[model samples]
Target: MKVIVVFGVFFFFSIAAVMAQPANRQVFWRDLQSRYEADSNRVVRVYLDKFGYFYPVNAIPIDKQLFLFPAREHNVNASTISSANLYAYFHANQTAQNALLNYYQVSQTGNFDRDYKKVEEQELRQISRQVHRLVENLQAKNIIFLVHGFNVTDPVSRYVFFEHSVSQKGYDTKIKPLYIEVYWDGLTSVSGTDLLAIWKHAQNNTRWVSLALRDLMRHLDDRLPFTIVTHSLGASVATGALFNTSSKWLADGNTHDVDSIASSIPAPVDVPIKLGMIVPAIPGGLTFVDFNHRSPDITTVANNIVGIAIGYNPKDYATSKAFFSTSFGATTLGCDHENELRNVSLALRGCGYSLAQVQQMIYPVQFTTPNIALGLQDHDFQKYMEDDVDFSLFLAKLFNE
Candidate 1:
C-alpha cells in the first residue's frame, strides 16, 4: 500500500511539473512588427479606448513593453507605423490621419450621445470624408471591425493579439479591407464579489460603445459596407448597440446638432451589413425582444443586415456560469439552446418578425470544446484563434472569399 501511494504521489507531481510551463509560446509584439517591417509599409491602426484613454491624439509611444494594463486617462490615440522606428511611426497622410484623429476626439466627449461636443460636429464630417478616402485607398467596399471581449484591459495587448492572430490565419493577405478594433474596459478580476461589478460595467460599457458605433455608422457614407465581428462580452455590446438603434435617430437620418452638415441623410438600407458574434456572453432572451415599445428591435436590426453569424460552444461554462450566477439570472447565448431557432421565432414574433425572416438572417455556428487537457482552454481566445481548433476553421468559413 505504501509503494502504491508513493507511485500515485509521484504521478501527480509529474503531471503538475509538465503543466507548469507556459501554455502559449509568448510572441513579443516587437518581433511580430519586425517580420512585417521589410516593406517598411506601416499599418495605420485605429484605437478607441474606453478604459483610461491615457494616450493623446498622436501621442508618442507611451510604453513599449506589453502587459495587462497599458495606460491611464480617458483619451483615444491615432498613429501610423514606420519601419525606421516601428515603435513610433507617425502617419503623415492627412486623410487617413485625420479620420483616426477624429475617432479619438469624439471618444473624449462623454459616453452618451446627447453630450455632443461643439467640435464633434465638424470632426464627424471630417471623418466621413476621410473614411471615403480610406475606402479608395483600400479599394474595397467592406470594412471589418473587430470587437474583443473581457479580461483584455490593455489596448496594446488586444491590438497585438488580434492583429497577430488575424495575420497568422492569413486574413491580411487574403482580405484587404481596412480593420478597426473597438477597445473598451472589458476588464474584470475574478473574485466572489467582482462578478456583479463586472456585469454592470459590461452593461454600461455596451450601451456607450454601441452608441459610439451607431454614431460612427451614421457619420460614414451610408453607402459603404460594414461588418462587425465580436467575441464574448463584445457580443453583448454589439447586440445592445443593434437593439438600441433609435428609430428617431434613423428617421432623423443625421445628427440633430445645428452645426452638423451630415444631416437628413437616407436611412441605412436593409441589406449588405453583417454582424458576427463569437461566443457571446449575453442573455439569450435579450437578442430579439425590445423591452421598450415601438423601439427598434432585433428584427429592425435584422432588416438592415444581410448576414448574421453567432458562434458558441455548449461547454463554455466560464461564460454560462458567469451569467447564470449573476443577479440577472439569465442564460447565456453562448451555451447550447436546443430550441435556438424556436426561441428566435418566439422573440421575433414579439418584435413582429416572421419565422422566414429569422431563417434569412440568423446563422448559428456551433462548436464543441477542444479536446485538450488544459483547464479553461474552452474559453481562451488563443485556443479559438491560435490552436488548430475548430473555431479557427469556422471563422475562415465565416469570412471566406
Candidate 2:
C-alpha cells in the first residue's frame, strides 16, 4: 500500500508537469509587466515582504539575471542576492532611475556590494512610501483588492493584467474604485506531490501577511469602503486580516489559530468588508461553525463580513484533494460546503448580524457550472475568469450590485 501511494504521488506530479502553462502564457505575463513598467505611476502594488517569488517581478522578463528591484526587498519584483542584475544600460532602472541619479551625480562607494545594498533599501523604501501616499490620497472611496492563491506563479503580472481587464469591462467606470493587486508569499509547489508542503507554507505566510495587511488598512482612510476578491487559499489570508487580531505569532514565532476579533478595530477595518471567495481552500466546518471552541471569545467567519460572494464548483478537483482530506470531507469548501453555507445564518445570529447581512451571502448554481473544454473536475481559476456569466455574477456580488 505504501508503494502504491508513492507511485501515485509521482504520477500525479508528472501529469501536472505535463499540464504546465504553455509558452504563449509567458508572452501575456511579460506584456503586462512591460505595460505596468510604462505606466507604473498610475497603479498601486502592495506585496508581502517575505521571500522572493518564482519569477522576476519588476524587470522585463528575460534570463539575463537583471532585476529592477534587488534582492530581499519587499516588492515581489526582485532577484536573489546572489543573482543580482548588473548595473548597466540594459539592466532595470537604467533608463529612468539611473538617469535621474546621474543627473544628481549621487556619489557611489567603491564597494559594489555596499553600494547596491544601499540602493536596494532606498528603492524599497520609496516604493513603500509611494503606496502609502496613494492609499491616503485615493481618488476613489471604494477600494477593491485582488489576491490570488497557492502555487500561482507570476501573480504580480497576472493580477495587474486582471485589474486592467476588469477595468476594460467598464467596471472602473461604474464602480470607480481604486484597484490594488495584493501579492503574498504563497509558496509555489515544486511538483504536484509538493502541493501539501506549499499549501501549509502558504497558510503560514497568510498569517504574517494578515498582520501587515491590517497595518496597511490602518493607514488608509477609514471612512471609505473596502472589498477583497480572493481565490483558493487566499481565503485564509483574507479571513486572518479581518478577524484574527492576535499578534502572538509575531512574539512567539508560531501560529495561533486566532479568529476572535474585538468589537472595535482601533481605526483598522472597523467597517464591514465585502469578501468574494472563489474556489477557496478553507475548511467548511470553520466557515459556518466555530467548532472545538477555537475562538471562545466568540465570532467566527460569518461575523467578520457584511457581505460575501462565494464562488464554488461541486466538482472541483483542487480543493477536494488539496490536503488529502477528501475522504474526511474536511476542507473542500469549494465543492462540499453548500449545506454548511445554508447553515451559516445559525452562526451569524450569535454575532448579532442583521437579517439583511445574513441574506447577502450568495451563490447561484448557474454561475458555477464548469465548461466542457475546461476539465470538468479541475480547479483552474482561469475557468472562472473565462466564463462571463460566473465572473460577472461574482463581481456584482462583490461590489453589492
Candidate 3:
C-alpha cells in the first residue's frame, strides 16, 4: 500500500514536470523570415487595442525587451519577447503591457485599452502599409489571426505560447499565412473573491473588442483569404464580428483615415473566410436561434460560412457549467455541453435546422483528453494545440491548402 501511494504522488508530479515551454520568439520568427525569397521579405503582423470606444484602429507594438507577469518558464536573460521589432516578430499594445507588468496593482476588472501616448497618423499607417506591402512582396495568399481566452490576465505569456505552438505544428504555412495576434482586456487581474463578476465582465468585454475585429474585417481587402482561430472565450470575438458586419464609419465604401484602403469589402464568395473555435467558452444555446433574440442567429451565419469548426471536449470541466458560469446562461455550458453535441443538434433540430445542415456548416472537432487525470488542464489551449493528436487533425481541416 505504501509503495502504491508513493508511486501515485510521483506520477502526478512527473506529468507536471514535462509541462511545455514556448519557443524563443526572436529565434522562431527570424527563421520564418529567412525562408522568404524577397530581400524585404517578412511576416506581416499588426495590433489593435482600443478600449471600448468600440474603436479598433491599428496600433504599433512595444519596441524593447519587456518583463511581463504570468511569465513563461524559460525566457532567455529573464526578458520576455518585445511585441515587435517590426519585419522580425509578434505584437501587444501599451495597455496589456502595463496591466501585466503591474498586475498586483491593477483594478480587479475592466478594459485595458488606453494608450500612454497619442499615436501619430503616420505611425499608425506604417505597419498597415508594411503588411499590405509584405503581402504583395511575399505573395502571401492567406492571413491567420489568433485570439485567446478570458482567464489570460497576462497577454505576453499567452502570445508567446500561442505563436510558438502554431509554429511547432507548422500551421504558419511559410509565407503563405500572415499571423496576427489579437489581445483584448480579458479580466486583467484577479479579484480574489468574486470570480463570477469577473467572468461576466470578461464575457461582456468580448462584445466591444469584437466590434474592432468587425471593422478590421471590413478594412481587410476582400481579395485576401483570411481565417480567425480562437480558443475558449475568444470565440466571441470571431462570432461577434460575423454578426456586426458593417461599420457606419466605413460604410460609405470610401477608404479614409489610414493609408491602406479597401473600396467597400464584399461577401467572401471568391475567398475562404473561416472561423475556428477550440473549446470555445460560449453558451451552446446561442448557436440556435433564441426566440427572445438574446443571441445572434448563429444558425443562419453557419450556413453561409465557408467553414466554421468547433472543437469540444466532454472532459474540459473548467469550461463545464458547474465551473465556467455560476448564474446566467449557465445551462448551455458552451465549451462542452452536458450531452455534448447531441444537445446542440437536438436544439438545432427544434429550430428547423436538419442535423445535416448543422453538421455541414458547423464542423464539430473532438479532442480526446489524453488522461482523465489531467482534469482542468484539459481546457488548456496549449495542451490542445501542442499535445493532442486530434488538434493536429483539426488544424489540417481549418488550414487546408
TM-score of each: 0.60, 0.61, 0.58
**Best by TM-score, which number?**
2
What residue pairs are clashing in model 2? none
- For model 1, residues 277-385, the per-residue Cα lDDT tens digits are 7777666544555422212223354466656777777667656563352234243576644544356557656776567766766777776656443333277655555
Worst lDDT 10-window in candidate 3: 255-264
**Model 2: per-residue Cα lDDT over 318-365, one tens digit each:** 775633434322445666555545555555544455566567654533
**Evaluation by lDDT, superior candidate among 2 and 3:** 2
Candidate 3 achieves a global lDDT of 0.48
Which regions in candidate 3 have their CA more than 4 angstroms from the true location? 1-50, 53-128, 153-175, 191-194, 244-271, 288-304, 321-334, 343-354, 368-377
Q: Which residues of candidate 2, in runs, are more than 4 Å off? A: 1-39, 49-138, 221-223, 245-267, 285-304, 322-330, 354-356, 361-376
Ranking by TM-score: 2, 1, 3
Model 3's TM-score against the true structure:
0.58
Q: Regarding TM-score, does 1 or 3 come out ahead? A: 1
When summed lDDT is taken over every stretch of 10 residues in candidate 1, the lowest stretch is 78-87
Q: What is the C-alpha RMSD of each candidate to the true structure, in Å?
A: 16.1, 11.3, 15.9
